[model samples]
Target: MSTEMISITSYCLKYDIEGSFIDSLEDGGLIEIVWVNNERFIPYSVLPQLERYIRWHYELDINPEGIETIQYLLYKIDLLKQEAADLRSRLKVYEGTK
Candidate 1:
């Protein structure tokens, strides 16, 4: 595995979280786990996302299904924001021609 990865076990132990939470995240497709020499590790690139999910789970008391729903809604909101920005840019172009 890459040196930029953190061991999942170590992370769980440090945070006092259960390993099954990571398993739930993996099953929910929220994060990818790499197996190196029979150990599970997560790349640094995904650490932020994992932390976000952890907060939602532990702090906000959200389950995996709730997290999945929140993720989907956030994705849709981002898409809508992008679409609005694109439309505004096109409108500006039209106004500039007038």
Candidate 2:
């Protein structure tokens, strides 16, 4: 609906990738495909992530299941990093009180 979406067909044509790759990503829950007026699109926000997955698939020859696992691990790692940063901030506040 917004201008921030790219048509899946145009993207595939521009990048020379298979449409089924996008379908597989959607099936693996790694990304969301938005359909409007009988056309499929992907939000620009997920382009970087989608490109990473594409690389993993095309360059590294990773499968959809493997991509799913990697995505899960990356998510966990981000959460842990955020948690660690919060803990550090609290620790700094406590240190300043002493």
Candidate 3:
């Protein structure tokens, strides 16, 4: 797997977000920061989540606690979806055996 990371400074400049906001996310355990070569970086794998967080903060004016709640809800929704899919597949297998 390719491990790509983006510098926090560049991300903040590009996204027009305050560095302190990113720091808050990290402090809140919503996102992680990787320190490499004395530079702070965020994994590229989390870009999608980071973008959503940016939208929540800037466009929706969501606070850190709200963001955390949304994240938890989204995670639960994903788990439910996966469980539903697994049940459907199992049902298909049972139907075939019937």
Candidate 4:
């Protein structure tokens, strides 16, 4: 799939977020900023994550550290889910051979 790059300034304006908030996310290694033609951009793929962070900050009143921790835990949960699916598939394959 092709990803579109959006300017950070435009994104912050559209979302009513501060640029420094995004900068903090970048510092925490949750998302990356790309520089194209002297403009900072974020990939479209990060929209979901960005939105989640926004909700956490606004609705849940979570700080950046809490958001980062939640992000890491969610990532771990996804990894564990994938691992469980893989193990189940392997078990099914072994059963088929029996």
Off by over 4 Å in 1: 1-3
Query: Model 4: per-residue lDDT, tens digit, 7-48?
Result: 999999998999998998889888888888899999988888
Question: Which pairs clash (backbone N, Cα, C closer than 3 Å) in model 3?
Answer: none
* Candidate 2 Cα errors over 4 Å, as ranges: 93-98
What is candidate 2's lDDT per residue for 1-98, written digit by digit as tens?
Answer: 45699999999999999999899999988899999899999999989999999999999999989999998999999999999999999999999999
Residue-wise lDDT of candidate 3 within 1-98, one digit each (tens)? Answer: 66799999999998789999898888889898999899999998878888889999999999888999999999999999999999999999999998
The deviation in Å at residue 31 for candidate 3 is 2.0
| Candidate 4 global lDDT | 0.90
What residue pairs clash in candidate 1, if any at all? none
Model 1 worst lDDT run, 10 consecutive residues: 1-10
Best by lDDT: 2
List per-prediction Cα lDDT, in the order shown: 0.93, 0.95, 0.91, 0.90
| 1-98: candidate 1 lDDT, tens digit per residue | 34689899899989999899999989989899999999999898999999999999999999989999999999999999999999999999999999
Q: Which candidate has the highest TM-score of all?
A: 1
What's the ranking of the predictions by TM-score, best on top? 1, 2, 3, 4
Clashing pairs in 2: none
**TM-score of every candidate:** 0.93, 0.82, 0.80, 0.78
Off by over 4 Å in 4: 1-3, 90-98
Candidate with more favorable, higher TM-score: 1 or 3: 1
Candidate 3, residue 53: how far the Cα is off, in Å: 0.6
Superposition-based RMSD of candidate 1 using all C-alpha atoms, in angstroms: 1.4
Cα error of candidate 1 at position 84, Å: 0.4
